[model samples]
Target chain A: MTIREIGDLLDARVLCGKDLDVDVKSACGSDMMSDVLAFVKHRAALLTGLVNPQVIRTAEMMDMLCVVFVRDKTPTIDMIELAEESGIAVLATSKRMYEACGILYANGLKGNGELHG
Target chain B: MGESLAFHYEVDGGDFTSAGQASVKIKKNLRQLGVDAETIRRVSIAMYEGEINMVIHANGGNADVIVDDTGVTIILADKGPGIADTEKAMEEGYSTAPDNVRSLGFGAGMGLPNMKRYTDDMKIESVLGEGTTITMKVNF
Candidate 1:
């Protein structure tokens, strides 16, 4: 699905890189960047509640197309700027973590396949 | 691009927020060099994990990236409390990082393992109370 669809499905607000709405696909939700990195598949978007700059760095390193912040958590200017620089889209949603993940999952975005080794 | 390109960075352990800057730059540089996306991702992820380890474990360190027609090589050297057991440290779930580091979403004992996972080849050398150096390669 496109990032735009993800936003509509999760009730997410686009924070940056709105131009990239068409390129992203799949989605992974996790606060742990390491876990996200551990399970690298074809997923192109990361949905996370974590707000640190490392989140952007992690997305950049993983070649993810975007990041979605759950529970209406706002990203700092630094985070938005980093996402802009890295060419990764950013979105924030008011839905709680579980519900947001559930909505996306129900809409055909798998966790890029199972969670562990 | 027949000639090898080398980039060096000094990892500042003083700031956690700045830990992955080197890897970010390297990723950008690799992209500019027209490297494939998969190779670039592998090289950056491995190097970023090593850079984070240097900041969290050793105070700070030095990283060097050498790119050529053959492969990309990342050399990370740090002068901090060295690993006591290289074998155990290589394990997927073993970590020496403090609790605070965990809050930052790392130190889950996956750093070294992830490094190994992303790189085509890796080697670790350490001296207790002295320092450690890791060499990893990702072929293009």
Candidate 2:
């Protein structure tokens, strides 16, 4: 799905990179930045409830096209600016983590898949 | 473009919010040099984890990124209290970070392991009373 479509489905507000139309095929939801760093692969959207500059930094490092904040959490001005600087689309949704992941998954966006040993 | 290029930055342990600035800069630098995306991601993630560890534990330190034909090398040095047990520390799910850090979405005890997971090679040198230095490499 396109990033714009994901936002539409999630009823999210586009905070930055509003024009980005990157395609997102997979996503991972977690409050732990380390897990995201350890597991996520390929270019995908990151669904996280955690709010910190590191969140944006994590997305940027993974070359993620977008970061969707679950549960209506507001990102700090620093985060918005960093996302803008990194050219990553930022979205905020009132939907909780599970619901958000489910919504995206039900609509064709799926997880990166099982971890390998 | 050069055979070997080095970038250095001083991490400010005073602020948790600003911990990964050096890693961000390194990511941008590698991108500008036309490094491959996967390699860039590996190097930056490992370095970013190291940067966070330094701030959360050592109160700040120095980070250096050296890029060459074979790979990228990251050297992180800090003067914080050294890890008591390297073996245990390297194990996943082992952490000494305070509770407040976890509230900020870190201190998951995955920092060192994640660093090793993403990099091609990792070495840690620490003097309990003195400090610690970690060197990680990622091939291009």
Candidate 3:
């Protein structure tokens, strides 16, 4: 799915990088940034309820195309600016984490599979 | 490759909000310096994890990124309480962070592991009470 589609599916508001129109194959939902770094692969949009600069940094380090904040969490101006600087799209949604993940999964965004050493 | 390009950042402890700023700056610098995206990503992730560890465990620290023809090295130094056991710290699920740190989406015991996973070379130096320094390298 594209960034645009994911935003629409989640009914999320684009907080930054609204110009981005990239396609993301998979999505991962987690509040833990470490888990995302250690295990996630081939996922583009990070579905998270956690709001912090590290969330944006994690997506940037992993080369993720977008970060979607779930459950109506408010991102500070710092976060929006950082996402803009990193060229990462940011979306905020009222959907809960599980519901957002389900919507994306039902819409055909699946994890690429396990990552091995 | 006439000289090594070096970047220095002093991580401020007690400021959880400012964590990862150095990594972000280094990532941008490397990008503009013409480093490949993949190598930049690896270095960024490695250094980011280090920065998080420094803030969460050490209260704050220093991070340096040195770049040369063959590789990039990140040196993180902190005077916080040193690791009691290197072997246990290296484990995938071993962490000593407090509950507050966990609520912030970190302290999952994957910081060190993630640092090692994304880099080509990694070494940790610690003195039970003195401090800890982590050095990581990612080769082109």
Candidate 4:
């Protein structure tokens, strides 16, 4: 699904890169940034409750399409600026991490099972 | 690339907000230099993990990136409390980060393992009380 479709599925608000359209097929939900970094999938977006700038950096490293901040956790201005600079979309939703991930997964996003190098 | 280029950054251990700044900048630099996307991503992720480790464990540190057409080299040096066991630290599920770091979504014990996984070569050198330095290389 595209980011727009994922947003609609989760009732998420685009915090930045509103018009940025990227096809996202795989999704991972984790508050652990290290674990997120462990799995780098193309055309992927992160579903996370963590709000720090590293979340954005982790996405950037994985060449991820966007970061969905669950539970309505807002990132700081610096993080927003960095996301804008990195050309990564940002979204926020009131749903918890589990619910947000479940909605997207139910809507056709998948979990990339390739964990080993 | 005409010649090998090096970029240096100071990691501020006290500032979690700025922890990954160097890796981000290096990613941008490598992109500008026309490094392959996969290679750039590998370099960025490895260095980013090292940068985060510097903040979470050591009280910040210095990062140096040397880039050329064939590969990128990362040297992370820190003057914080050194690792007591490099072997244990390299384990995939072993993390010594404090609870505070865990709240920020780290301390999964994957930092060192991920750094090694993403890079072509990685070396960790340390003195228990003085410091630790990690050297990683990612080939293009």
Best candidate, DockQ-wise? 4
Per-residue C-alpha lDDT of model 4 across residues B15-73, encoded as one tens digit per residue = 88778888988988998988889898889899999999999888899999998777999
**Candidate 2, DockQ to 2 decimals?**
0.69
RMSD of 2: 1.5
lDDT by residue for model 2 over B20-99, one digit each (tens)? 99999998899999999878888888999999999999999999999998999999999999988999999988889999
Q: Number of the top candidate by TM-score?
A: 2
Local accuracy of candidate 3 as per-residue lDDT tens digits, B6-89: 999998888887888898899889999999987887888888889988998888999999999889999999998999999899
Q: Which scores higher on DockQ, 2 or 3? A: 3
lDDT (Cα, 0-100) at B35 in candidate 1? 94
Q: Model 2, A53: alpha-carbon shift in Å?
A: 1.4
Task: Identify the superior model by TM-score, candidate 1 or candidate 2.
Answer: 2
Alpha carbon lDDT at B99, candidate 4: 84
TM-score of every prediction relative to native = 0.95, 0.96, 0.94, 0.94
- Candidate 4 lDDT (Cα, whole model)? 0.88
lDDT of 4 by residue, A1-117 (tens): 988887888889888985556788788999898888888687888998888888988888888888999998998888888889888899888999888888888877888735636
What DockQ does each prediction reach against the true complex?
0.60, 0.69, 0.72, 0.79
Error of 2 at B85 (Å): 0.3
Query: Fraction of reference contacts reproduced per prediction?
Result: 0.62, 0.78, 0.73, 0.80
Clashing pairs in 3: B13-B59
What would the per-residue lDDT of candidate 2 be over residues A25-79, giving only the tens digit for each residue?
6789989888888875666889998999989988888888899999989999989
